[model samples]
Target: MTVKKGLKDAYSLKTPMDSVNLYRAWASTYDNDFAIKNDYRSPSEVVKYYSKYSKKTDTPILDVGAGTGLIGECLREQNSRKIDAIDISSEMLNLAKSKQVYSKFIEADLTKKLNIASSQYGAVLSSGTFTHGHVGPEVFDELVRILKPGGLFIVTIHTGVFHNQGFKQKLSQLGKCISPPVFHKVNAYGSKIDKKHGNDKVIITVFRKKMS
Candidate 1:
């Protein structure tokens, strides 16, 4: 994949919010420039892996930071289930909505309190939230609260130097308050061409909420 020098430069920035804004600005060209590259297989693989354990029930799925609904579309392809996509960027959600891949799209920051109600989702899946540091540990509680008992939370994180052990520990602490959620590493892949910095080792993690 040919990496644009401008995107490479942007990836080297010190803050995660810089990357988020950069993505927000490039949301229009995101699919052509980044998402479709690498055979569009990275995010597709994430959804495919998680779908295996998802219950056959027609439960609602929430895709956090659901940029352009790539993962959501993949999930829909795997199973005829309803998906709600949420992202902070309207531009991104606009592209996602145009595809008609999600049943609902909400513009909201996952790091803040999500407006979603407790026990609303049977499963929550996120493909690109943690890697860019757009979300921190505090958001896990909201994710847990939004999921029904025995629900699943699937997320992806960068595995190399950028991985936040401190934030993971904080999430672990918060897990103690919820029904014991178990975290398991699912798969690893490369980031977008713009995110070539830090060696960009993408690791997907799955957390399943225990039934009461």
Candidate 2:
């Protein structure tokens, strides 16, 4: 929980409390130590795809597992839409708050129902949330529930668990509720510079809620 080991510590987290403890210790320096040092690319990549596929620009957006406001920061550079940040760690949320990039911040566990109403957001983008020991495909139901009809839901899922963790099957089962997922594969880190997790990849899954 007292994570000093960076990515390994993040990937080894098992319980929600484990995540809380890890981020609590890592939050202050997360931007420089974890994201910049590792050359993390998921946030930018996910946002890039969000801009590419999103049809609306004014509706509210929810940044899940927003962690230090990386996604919100990237989003702000592109638009002025109301973007809200949500994460499980208050410490991390505090760091995100300092960035002043989000309109609202919600601290909640993704494993349970968010206090938000259904079909509220025009688009929802999450980066570095669905991975080794963090969140899983089960949160997809709640995510979809909060998304408006025809809303875009874009997220990065660690490729290592895509098929084994039932994400593929779960997405398939959501047939009528969502459109078929469009997967964009990208390196989680700048492979050329970071040798440790250089080969690590995440599937940026893009889908929309059915208007019906």
On lDDT, the leading prediction is 2
Per-residue lDDT tens digits for candidate 2, residues 159-178, read: 98899999999899898899
Q: How high a TM-score does candidate 2 get?
A: 0.96
* lDDT score, candidate 1, position 137: 59
Could you tell me which 10 consecutive residues in candidate 1 have the lowest summed lDDT? Answer: 2-11
The list of candidate 1 runs beyond 4 A from truth reads: 1-20, 161-165, 177-199
TM-score of each: 0.80, 0.96
- Candidate 1 lDDT over residue span 1-212, tens digit each: 43342334433545546656766677777777665653344467568657656776526888887888888778767777888888878878998998786899888877678788888888888775665335555677888888887787777765642345455675567665454444445333345444434244455566677666
List where candidate 2 sits over 4 angstroms from the true fold: 1-3, 192-194
